[model samples]
Target: MEEMMRSELVSMSSYCRRYGHLKLHDFSNPSFKKTKYSPTKVFVVSSSSSNSTSPPPLPQNPIFQSFFFPVTPSPIIPYLQHCSRNTKKRKFTPSSSSGSVKVISREAFNAAVKKPSVAVKKPTVAVKKPTVAVKKPIVDVNKPTVAVTHDRGVRKSSSWVKSRLLGKGGYGSVYLATSKDGRYKTERAIKTAELSRASSLMDERRILKRLKSPFVIYCYGDEIVREGTSDCYNLILEYCSGQCLADVIEDNQGGLSEFDVKLYAKDVLSGLSYIHDRNIVHCDIKPDNLLLTPVDHRFRSNGFLTKIGDFGLAMEKGSVEYGNGCGHKRGTTRYMAPELIGHGVIDFAVDIWAFGCSVLEMLTGVQVWGEHGDLVYDDWVSLIGHSDLIPNIPSWLSEEAKDFLKRCFVKEPNARWGINELLNHPFLSSNQVFSHNGFIYE
Candidate 1:
């Protein structure tokens, strides 16, 4: 009986493959792409006659089609196959119903994705709750928002036209939309994380809301979108017509000099200092996050108008300490700090560490670490010693750059000077231009 059943299962699986591609109504839904769902396959599961009293024929199930295919499971698989062929005998009834498939609902099938027998590893994800206690941003009572949103900050309807997709990010999608009157237009960036929820993301929203600086993108709104048990949220923002620092330098070929670089760095540090004073940590800081505006009279007053953008990886002070069990690791790996590698407690200096890397790139036309820049962190570390951690400094870079780097990239986070002090440094205060190729920073 067992052998017969095994053969039946194997045969049924094979039958499914024949018509598996036949058009079946909506079914299979890949959770990541929520809108694009795929339904389960339908197969002929009935016998030839409607009145036939015989057992129901297990029409080849497309779901189990993999088993029907000719596959040598393994070295041991050969032995099992031989034994099964010799010992097992099964009977199968043919079905006459037109071949069709049913796509299993995600609710039922999400339980055992891929196949049976494969043990799945459960991930640790935060179950974020909506904070009714928190107040919404102060929008003009007169300027209309989505109706009924004034109470709980929840949109009464999905009237927010996706508008044009401004940009797609790792966590969320961005769109460009104007107010109902076209008087105010802002860039709406939605943040999403596959492995986790957006509870920890409020740090960015909170920081952006308080900021009223020309160097920071103004956040216009915040809301959450939920699917099943998982919920995703986004931050609506004021659009900036500008190029990123990464693109600016790349287009400039190599790196920008002491003057333009310093100007960019100053504005960037000014933004960072503001974030620090507000008790926030911009954990993921890089040239790409820096936005450069078009030569407008307002910004032409300042050299390269650099503004800090994207705070998806930010955290509050002391949140990622050495002993904390948050297991939260976020930041660009190339520009990441040594302490943030794999499993280590990190501090605000981690931001400084990344800034040191960025400044080094500004000075030299290369990444502090990574391809087209330095590929290995150890090489840079070896070149620039962890002097504060050691009695004396390592010998590779000039005393000037080395000393400045040591002050910022301190091994211990607490002793590091905050962004304000770094801004006050002589290196940034001077109107200097280190030559690059033959063109000076005009």
Candidate 2:
């Protein structure tokens, strides 16, 4: 039996080495392009199950045990799994009959891998009869269900039969939920509101549906439902995990470095240009709305790919004009544009204005438009009329960054910077080969 066990293991080992590429036990290399391997099988050999009554001891578990395992050549990669060991030193590789797997000492391996305890004793429990037939409390069959709530509206809010808080909004609440039908399951954010605001929420949805871009956060689903004490509609959205650029900046304390500001600003512009091309105007663009995609913190991550989310105040190109006093201001105070207050179409220029504001915020930890006052509009006019009101470019910014932003914050929208120009700008173009892990830190 021992001879047979040795023969079988030898065959397995031979098979693994023959197609090592396909069954690479090494976990360190993620790049599959290094070799052409074809795995044919993956096996978990249990010494306890061998025909030989006296099984070999366990070896110390290797960090890259998969590297030693046999693999099947199927396209579907199979992960190596082993039951955890409690009593013995667990090892990964199979050595010769002399117990040559070097990761662990022979004594430790024997002590660690003892046979599982057997339950041979006949165990019995005394049974008792219940005096009463206890029943669970019944809920009212006709009671209304709770509506999903969220901090914001997003596509995940529109699931059916999942009456739970999906998320919360500054104006409403959101719920993260799963639907009764697994097919409908989604991680979502929903904005809740009184029935009176249904029309506005729908309007926002209409604008959101038409705008598309990889840089923009997408709406997944939506629904109008009744919340506690009031009938309301909820806007569901895709789950985005990173802090808004606002929070990221605040976390940095003083402000973003010049390089990061340019990086984030470029993505913001790309998102805007996509929306504008579709004739949609994001009336509100602020740090809260400009989002970043979360990534592994250990590795270097890009803050540059900012996804523009939350189109609640967005409008289609031909939508009716809304002045500040007449409607729900529809924008953050500081980011609101001069033309937006006049009930004019503000066009795509409003977004450009907001983008400029965001850039200033990124450079200096202050809102570009300052507070609303007599000088507010006057400041905008002067800034729009004269280029100096824009935040002073940090000396660290490149000459190209200075020119790119100068174009973005131009006094006139028509003359302002466009997406293509910004993308091709020197700041982004300079990085030929980049990686989050300092392959190219700059």
Candidate 3:
């Protein structure tokens, strides 16, 4: 019986596929059409004949067919029962007229119980609920921001007053901010970006919190400020009123005195030493990234203190091993090492190369690429081979200072002197006194 039922089901499916428009309609009425939700197969019919009677022979042309009698156990009932058992319960109702056929919706079929057929009414229209205004999420002003890491000083954005725009770049902008709290004396520089730029900014904030060095910019905390629709992130960092080393050079008629260069370079090297010791590389080391803070009373002098800033391009040295190929080029173009430009193996030496370029620019008041006023790729290629094609060394700079730069400019990364060696060089030693904190001297 099961096998016979399966064969009938397969045949019915085939028929539906062959004639998708096949549907039961009143043969006496040509105007009748099927509805959008009408079933494709299995037309039902009512008969006054006994249950033991077999259905009358189906006409060869279905368009002219008419039901004469009903078969025992109605062939459709067993099939529909099997289908309903295999699937879900559905509601169904048979037509009232003794010889009329009925169509039931899938929903009606699923909801129906086994009983005598009855007329089904059309579904009614449903009313929708009224909309209500949604309020913005209320933030607890007392709650502190807790990111990937947490610190005690983290506070709400409302507590800080954003003053003027300090600077702006691809990552976003830096604004001068002051705390409303009287305990906060010094102004803070808040680096901000839209939520779309959260990843890089968040990474920087995490890194800043882990670092603790006098030469590196200090991070206080972070906060999220809500705009009309979108939110923005604000990273609080130590503000350097004296500005960047690049600006300082511009103020000094495009170049710094040899003494000043040595002093600033020592400060940069101190930061680099601390960073490299922790296995991190400051990939984008340049004058712009070296911020100058005014000398405190302890180091009373007109000279400003240099600190490394802008750690957006920093990366852990051994995080991911690189195969023998050019890695992605990162960092300022003018300060890029030859290997960095060629997509060669990158390491701490790249920072050393950039430091050399920065030092040269400070002394000569010229760009690394514009050293001879006619810089070219060929010059870089020659330098990569240990050729004596160094950047133009000013005659005013002592030979010791020139030699110290040459050591930093060595094409072979392994041959280049590191931060510790560079710090101890005679040139940097001439102006700066070591052993103050013993951090750099050690």
Candidate 4:
């Protein structure tokens, strides 16, 4: 019986070698009768017919062990072992059930038999962020939006909603402007002029760009905007909530108190000093151009901070032209200095002379040259230019105030005290504070 069993196993091995590609049922194991043929479960070996003693021992190769033993065996394992042991060169013909054969090269077969390499994960690298450029937006006249470049080269867009007309001048009309989007908390004054006649506004913008001082009205920036059919040049400036010194005096029903005058004079001098140091001359320095800003207790108890504004008539010190044409003066007639009227000479001293006139008006609440009366422009020119008379300094003023005005009113521009010298005067050195009686508007 044992001899018969060995013979049957030898026949089965021979049958497997002849038809390795065909599916074979395992009749010896009835339990596997219903299972389909799987390559991983079918590695079998038998003694060769020439040497029928004992079946040759399985290969000790780790590659063979990793491919076959622990899991169910595959027919490809013994086929691969045969390929590796055979000395004769033979093509590996892998067949499918459809009777088609695929010829795999020796190198491909070897590569398939070799162990697959484990994949390595690469280290992550950091990428730098890219910088973005800002593009300027197109101005929309209907929306009234403007793209403004600020101090640090940073650009931003702002929309100003125009409200009431603050005032009008020869250069342009000043309007109260508030930010439409609430980005800017404070109210602003926008001075606008038709582009064709915007020379004064342009010049003022250039001059204001160079000036920086708390006592001077600040220029935020300027933009060219379209209004209806006309392109307008707009200058954005700090808005003073109070009023001009002229209006303030009129509201008070008389000249301001000496305390108020000294307080305002100090700030004006400080602003003048800053501009004069840079060789700028404010040709117009009347009370109407000196603006009062509301302030908190930290600044002054008077509820106002005097700031110098209206730089439309200002020019660089040596570049000032005395008249436009036909012997007409550039500034208001009442504040013109003797040198400015007589010789057409203009300099920083003209500002001092006008400042003196403004102080007098603030004290008297009236024009320095009095009413026009019967005097025409030429008549007034003759009277002021040819005569040696100066504006009358009131008798009620203190000696220090009288002396300060005298220094400012000197006929010869060279002899007049400069802004620095006047700042040291006793009139401005007073430390006394006064109470404000609140503004009275007509």
**Candidates sorted by lDDT, best first:** 4, 3, 2, 1
Cα RMSD of predicted structure 2: 40.5
Best by TM-score: 4
Model 2, range 338-410, lDDT digits (tens) per residue?
A: 5554334366776876787787778777656544344665454454334445445556555766676676666
RMSD of each: 35.9, 40.5, 24.1, 16.5
Could you give candidate 1's per-residue lDDT for residues 69-142 as a string of tens digits? Answer: 32322333344444656753433434345432233445445566755785677987889987788787886432
Residues 66-140, model 4: lDDT tens digits: 333334434454455556566455574544343333446887679888958778878777787787888978643
lDDT of 2 at 148: 28
lDDT of each: 0.56, 0.58, 0.69, 0.72
Candidate 3, number of clashes: 12
lDDT of 1 at 181: 37
Error of 2 at 196 (Å): 1.5
- Over 4 Å off in model 2, which ranges? 1-171, 174-185, 295-300, 319-330, 341-345, 370-398, 431-435, 438-442
Q: Each model's TM-score?
A: 0.50, 0.53, 0.59, 0.60
The model with the greater lDDT, 2 or 4, is: 4
Show the lowest summed lDDT stretch of 10 residues, model 1. Answer: 33-42
Superior by lDDT: candidate 1 or candidate 4: 4
